[model samples]
Target: MRRAFFYGWVIVATLFVVNFATHATGNMNLGLFVIPMSDEIGISRGLFGWLTTSRTLAAGLASIVIGRLVDRFGARILIPASALITGLGVIAIGSATNVVQLFVLFAVIGFGGLSPQGGGLLTSVPVAKWFVRKRGTAMAVTSMGLALGATTFVPVTQFLIGAVGWRRAWFYLGIISMTMIVPTALTFLRRQPEDMGLRPDGDADSRLGSGAAQRSEAADEAVWTLGTALSTRAFWMLTAALALGGFAAGGGVHRIPYWIDSGFDHDLVSLSISVHAASAATVMLAVGILLDRVPARFVAAGPFAGFSIAIVIMLSADSNTDMFASAVIWGMSAGTGIVSQPYLWASYFGRSFLGTIRGVTMPTILVATSLGAPAMGYVFDFRGSYDLAWQVVVAIYAAAFLIMVSVSPPRLGRPLAD
Candidate 1:
């Protein structure tokens, strides 16, 4: 396979491992600890959810810093540092005994190691750099690492938490982070293809007799910088749609607790989340390939519709089967969105500026995602049902879907003709 395989694929596989480990310790996995940690620490559900808010706030800030680092220094440094910080944070989580501890520790985790599954913008920049023609497929497949992490970690954490305790689960994850992710980041990762004497997608050397020195993509391709992209109406529209989508996706944090509260079995709730992640992982390759071949907006829009339908199903679910059904649909849609966002950026604006551009847009997405958990918790705390939060999520998804369908790529000098 080496004879025909792209080195970019090697980079992808390494990032897959890095993402799997980082995401396994992320807030999504914290859903498993909602009841245990809150009960043990003697905090309200709404208060516990605020810890997620703190974590998101921390990551949102860190993303901006890391974004500059990514563009300047590259993933080789950031990925490992993020992993180590995340590991220490996870290990420290076991020691948390109060809301203060929870807030600080989770914030640390957010800063050190949260990707929302692409290690925030760190992973996306590299993918944008390495695979232009196949960026969609590469991102789709690579993004599966998060779902796969969830698929594996959710069930394992459930068991570990059930057996030894949540504390031990965090401890075990920290060990894995240090041992696995640290080495992988150091050895398997590279900054970009050019350093290795290759071109994006390994494009042919225009000079036949010469070695792999390649032509630049274009001198006038008009990469959208942060300021220029911000000037466009398309930027705001995509931001609005994605922020809402992010808010809706935040449903993952409270998924276990929501089901458990609705008289659903604890084991079943865990299984539903695991199955959801698995379902998303299952279609990631297909979505990746589809993004390469289709109009990304068209591909992106279906998931938002699925998100709406899934919320409707959640509203009336009566059994574990119903919850699982809803999760599958939601997971598939979530999977599609993860891959499409990066593809859309690369395709629409060009790859040269992806790191900075993504950095600019990330805070809203992360903040919106943060809002979901606390909103669900607050509504449930007040109303004693998840009904209100789900209702709001449904509306957001509807609005997001409409906005996404209406958006077009930003042009170089155009301001707001839309």
Candidate 2:
């Protein structure tokens, strides 16, 4: 019997919550902890910034193993386990007395929870596997969690730090992480639609059985394995483009600190994060539809171009008006970037081996990302300004934009259609 509603949408919703909860602990909110923790612990900004670097580096290395597990066992086991580990790790961070403790916990438990599958990678892959025609829309919806998490958590963390202490704030947020993520993930997530006897996009099975020709066509759909995909020019170019984008994206870790240094009120700095996230959330649905309709390369280029311009605006800004305007532009661009990378991976290579394909790229992307924030912090430490760091990020964005525009999907076998 045909089910009245698609189960894939349920999968999308589950991953949405996963994205939301996991990102609440992500580096975007690190600025909230940076000043307070560094002040209390007497660590320099450059040294404290290594927490993000450690987390990303560990997550990148773990992605090599986790990616294959996701492909083989699915996210059902991995995501919840990661969340559980993440929750305990985050709570442990509350009691940390030194840089070493923070580094070890964040790197191991935090990275274990969020990388390869949880943070954005695993959540996106399952959604991609569940839909083809609707892949872009599903991805757009899933990515809303990322925006929402930032929009809510930045201010909430800011408020919590003010009302209580940063340590207690960490405890509360960690509790929330486990409460929101672990139970739902265990209850709802499944490997793919096929495991439940459903086809991608909820297409009627009868369509494929209509004739011999259709059966042949279905059998001929392109399948790109990790080994073969790595051999293609598209793979390397896309990897370079995404890795550069990852590095640029990490600049968020210092955004709050930069604003505060620029003499903005603390509340105003937090508000800027909300504005950026809200703008990204608002544009994401439209970007998703555009991704489905537009050529993949053009859609991929939009974020890089937007980031370049946005950073330039931010560097020159001296007023509150200019700051918020920069945030809006970055938000719009970031929304597209969040959706485009995974969409490109699945659409370009096909979905069967998405976990493995995305996994292999993790180390390069995470390592590049790991470098960005500390680079900014150390620049500020040594130079007394963030001027040089933003300049470097702008160049990285330009490079990514050029590479992204040049990329075309690799032709493997018969084309896979939406």
Q: Can you give the TM-score per candidate against the true fold? A: 0.93, 0.93
Q: Put down candidate 2 lDDT per residue, 1-418, tens digits, no spaces.
A: 4567888989988888887886556445768888889899887777776788888888887777777787777888888888888888888898999889988987976467463222366688788878888889999999998888889888988888999999988888889888998889899998866666567777644333324433333443477888889989999999898889888877677888888888988898889888898888998889889888987788978998898887888888899998999889989888888888789888888777788888888889888887887878899899999888899898989999999999987887544453
- lDDT, each prediction: 0.77, 0.81
Off by over 4 Å in 2: 1-3, 115-119, 205-220, 414-418
lDDT of 2: 0.81
TM-score, model 2 to reference:
0.93
State how far residue 265 of model 1 sits from its true place (Å).
1.6
Q: What overall lDDT, based on C-alpha atoms, would model 1 receive against the true structure? A: 0.77
Tens digits of lDDT, candidate 1, 206-256? 232222222243332455677888888988888888888888877667777
Q: Model 1: runs farther than 4 Å from truth?
A: 1-3, 117-119, 205-221, 413-418
**How far off is model 2, as Cα RMSD?**
3.2
